[model samples]
Target: MDALGFSENLRVLRKNKGFTQKDLSDKIGVALSTVAMWETGSRRPGYKTAQRVADTLDVSIDKLLQDEALSGGEYLSENELYSRITPKTRNANHDLLEIREVLRTRPEMKMLFSVSKGATKSDIERAVAIIEALKKDRG
Candidate 1:
């Protein structure tokens, strides 16, 4: 892990959030010198302090530590995607879970099908058509 890389990312995020070193230190209850040291890569913060900084900056600890990974847009290979997905998708899964919850509560739009019994052939076909239409719109 590159300490300088992490430091740069932390600095960028802090500035983007309009926080001076003193502002960040005050928010996270650290000394301004400590924040300055961390930002300059002269020293690293402890795990707890690092987490506090991340929280105050509204970024994940992994994101703070591995800034390079977050900045690139290269399409990942299968194994790369699998490894990269775990932590990143933990946040995404929370969003997906909320979507699932909302979808569960939503009344069936396909009233033509008896959902209780199971989707009929026409219902499946219609659902597929709806999905294709949505895909087209998105594209």
Candidate 2:
């Protein structure tokens, strides 16, 4: 969104909450001119103040930054998707290794041992392909 768009959005939210610029400034512990500058598109709040405004407005920081529908909805940008998935995927991979270790000593997996113990060429190729895809998709 443009600066003017951001300004308008802030003003609308403040008005909807029945707050004057001074009232919002007081609530967020900012100077009145800071709020005025934001509303007039002459300046923007710093990250800290932006966060406070989002909290005070009962909105997410992402929503306050961008007024696009996707910003408020389920869609994530490529960078956002990567940032969100990286740690989660790494943790899950660690858990999977632990499961593999546990299964190595489990009698219940004996019947499936032959299939798992001897990897076919196709199985190896598929695993490589999956790894390549994951690497390619990571941003």
For model 2, residues 11-113, the per-residue Cα lDDT tens digits are 8778878899999999999899989999899998888888899899887665566644332335557687457556877798799898788678786665455
lDDT against the true structure, per candidate, is 0.78, 0.77
Task: Assess the local accuracy of residue 8 in candidate 1 as a C-alpha lDDT between 0 and 100.
Answer: 83
Kindly report which residue pairs in candidate 2 clash with one another.
none
lDDT, model 1: 0.78
Query: Which stretches of candidate 1 lie above 4 Å from their native place?
Result: 67-139
Each prediction's RMSD over C-alphas, in Å, is 13.8, 16.2
Number of colliding residue pairs in each model: 0, 0
Candidate 1 local lDDT, 33-101, one digit each (tens): 998988788999888888999999999777687635334444446576457667767788889888677
Q: Global lDDT for candidate 2?
A: 0.77
